[model samples]
Target: MEKEKVVLAYSGGLDTSVILKWLENTYQYEVIAVCINVGQEEDFDAIQQKALSTGAIKSYVLDVTEEFITDYIYPTLKAGAVYEDDYLLGTSFARPLMAKKLVEIAENEGAVAIAHGATGKGNDQVRFEASVKALNPYIKLIAPWRIWDLKSREDCIEYALKNDIPIPVTKKDIYSRDNNIWHISHEGGNLEDPWNQHDDSIYKLSVSPENAPDTPAYVEIQFETGIPVAVDGVKYSPIELLTVLNEVAGAHGVGIIDIVENRLVGMKSRGVYETPGGTLLFEAHKTLEKLTLDRATMSFKKSVSEKYAQLVYDGLWFTPLKEALDQFVDSTQQCVTGAVKLKLFKGSCSAVASTSPYSLYSEDFATFGEDDVYNQQDAEGFINLFALPLTIRALMNHNKDQKNKTDKKVI
Candidate 1:
């Protein structure tokens, strides 16, 4: 008589393959599953043989794709974190690294509780139980779609057709996707209709800016202190430089979006996403941080990239203010090194040129055919010391309107 181990973050789909046989027929619990690849073009030996043919006394898959591109997509692409600025949080920082590898395989399988299949209406069940209560606050967490009786995806596809269990998904194209290598979202059927549009056969990883490639491609990239290794000049290693910029920006359709967001569980969903090579590495690291930041550190890193994209889209990735906003985004990526040069087209990508050897752009102090670093009459003593407080508030509103016109002629 022995049966009580849990673990499960499995993903052979159809809701963790019917929550791995509904957590062993509703709580007899022995499931072990894992599966934290992070690059999501799965097969992984058929999802670890369908998690040991759907009962999972044990089954992992852990590739961590170069520790998910050097610890969560290069510190959220060196903290230019996006989210509401159109999400590149990519499944919000890959569900806190798949809940820290399901609490490290439930503390190496002594497992007492860790299930997940994230669905009590989504934000990935608070990003997989707040990253397993911020990395093991004494494990125990199971979720079974917030306590199951299988109340939906068509009653868990009729309880995986009465537990014969080989599911993928049906009921005519159930969307709810979530791939990796940087992005692929989608979200429930007809993208939960915010005026239902999404259907160019739900374009997996791209191709539908009116069926792309009519021409226009460019693509240069390079970066360093701010990550991305190389593309055109060809260096590639962070997973072959994002798989050759997601196959040349998904053949020109360049990262699709389609938002409607706002869902830290307060609801307002409607997704779509795609992010072909994380939109050409976030437009070549924001055009090499506008040729190496500065303008008050690029306006205080745009409010620390919107509070680091709302604390990594609200999962709060192992806190302490996201480790002091990743040390202020690694001191603004040192000198954000550079290269840029983008183009893409069809769905438009832009940033068509940038250089940076710490460039603060100087074309000889921005010339209009001028010469000696100008002092054109020193701009009238710097516009009278920058309009000295608007000329002393317009001479104190003209001496309070001439003392109300000499007290209205002595009343």
Candidate 2:
């Protein structure tokens, strides 16, 4: 009889590399490693070779960068879903796409089980398993960190050394990182301590603000239906546009965030993220929304944005709530078409100018000088009617207080 097969999500990192070897030894199963490239700057050939040498029966590198930007990143960008007012959902958004591809490969290769390197704690496990269950419920999930005795990054390193498995990380530099086209997130090591300041050497995608350029850089971004289409009057594809912005904004140290966030596993984790391109796009999109969307719609959308951020952070991407939220978000983007000029200085991006054909802002009605569009005298009646309840309540309170004073005098 043929041996059972398990497809493992391999990253050629310390944990997953060790898990690849352990799965083969412990279960005596054929371990096929699948590495999905979602714009993480890595050599696919080298990672594939490393996986195969470390006891993987076979290895596959799937390039899904285009799909990642067009489908996952763009939709999240349009929704304005920033997790905890800082994180751009970099790691949160990548998991579902990776899980989707993992299920596809499992079905194609006739594998019975899929495995991941996510620890017992953290949101990645939830994101991975939730996606797998949504796509292929019958497939068994083999999470090594939860089931195996090897605990902590140190234990995994020791296991790798004992088993003669080649590992990429060392004990001294054991920062757990996740990178993509959008951003790079750094956790663990000194970052685990919330009070400790992040060393500047940790940032990979952006420069230190202290070393940023003295002069501010000005750029114009064009958007259509809430999607960024061009930069500095040059039209490019979504991926190309972001790539250019990353270089320009990164030079000025624009998008670096250090925060202690609540993890989905009932613990707090500190992380530093660099998101130059994502930061620029978010600012540009928001500027356009302010011009096109009405006050009421924008206010309601703020509420929706918060819920959307929570859903993405909790790894609930492949659910009905997310889909419904997306529908509502899509409807609001119909008139969000415009161009915004932004000034990028050391660690800050501000809108300098914005214009749109669909803008709700009318200069004629809002002018300080005399204007026929809006009557200045109409404000008195509007204010009186609007404050009727307050006016009546104040009068009633005064009358009661006067009656009390008279009663006290009689006593």
Candidate 3:
């Protein structure tokens, strides 16, 4: 009989490397490692070799950068989904796409089971499993953190050393990190203590605000239907645009966020995120929307954005509700074409100026000097009609209060 085949979502990182080896030795199963690249810095050939050397039957590396941006990142960006009004859903949104690829590879390899490195406590576990369940429910899912006796990262490290597994993290400098083109997140070190400030040495994406350049940098972003198409009049591919923006913004120390967020697993976890390019893009997009979108649409979209952010954070990306929300978001983006100039200073990305062909703002009507539209005399009747219900309610309440006082005096 052929050995039971399992496909592992390998990251070429410490946790996944150990999981890849452990699955093979523990269960006597054939493991095929699949590493999907989403623009994180890595040696792809080396990752493949590492997995194969660690007793994997085979390994595959897929470049999903374009698809990741167009399918997942852009839609989420258009929806303006920011979890807890801070996180840009960096890791939260990345998991579903990763899991989708895992399911696809498992089907291709004729694998009976799929394994992941996400721990039981983190949101990635839910995101990965939920995505698999939505895509292919028949495949058996193996989560080592839930079943294995490895209590912590330290325990995993010891196990790796015992089995001669080469891992990256060391005891002295141990920080759980996840990086991609869009953002880099740091956790599980000094971040565990909310009181401790983020160390300058740990930040790889951006400089510290204090050490940033004195002069501000400015860039003009061009958007079409809410998607950023150019920067400073230069048309760039999705990857190139983000890459250039990351360089420009990171140098200025923009997009650094440290927060203690409520995890999906009913616990709070502290995390530090650096999303330089994404921050600049979001700021530009938001500024353009303010100029183009109507007051009612903007107000309604705010509520939708909150719900969308929570759903994405909670790993409900593949569900129907998210799809429906995406349709509404797409509709709203129709008029969000514009150009926005942003001034990037130390730790800040502020909109300098914005202009949209579909802009609803009327300078003539808004001017203090003179306006052809919007009659000033119409305000009196409009105010009275709008306030009628409030006026009536107050008068009736006063009359009732007077009656109550007279009744008390009589008694």
The regions of model 3 sitting more than 4 angstroms off are 161-164, 167-172, 401-411
Identify the superior model by TM-score, candidate 1 or candidate 2. Answer: 2
- TM-score result, candidate 1: 0.37
Candidate numbers, best TM-score first, in rank order: 2, 3, 1
Least lDDT summed over 10 consecutive residues: which range in candidate 2?
Answer: 167-176
Model 3 compared with the native: what TM-score? Answer: 0.96
- Cα lDDT of model 2 by residue, 176-290, tens digit: 7899999999999888888899999998988998889999999899999988899989999877898999999899999999998999989998999999999999999999999
Model 1: residue 249 alpha-carbon error in angstroms: 34
Model 3: pairs clashing at backbone N, Cα or C within 3 Å: none
Q: Model-by-model lDDT, in order?
A: 0.84, 0.92, 0.92
> Given candidate 1, what's the lDDT at residue 294?
76
Q: What are the TM-scores, per candidate, against the unseen true structure?
A: 0.37, 0.96, 0.96
Across residues 228-311, which tens digit of lDDT does each residue of candidate 3 receive? 999999999999999999999999999999999999999999999999999999999999999999899999999999999999
As for TM-score, the candidate ahead, 2 or 3, is 2
Span of 10 residues, lowest total lDDT, candidate 1: 167-176
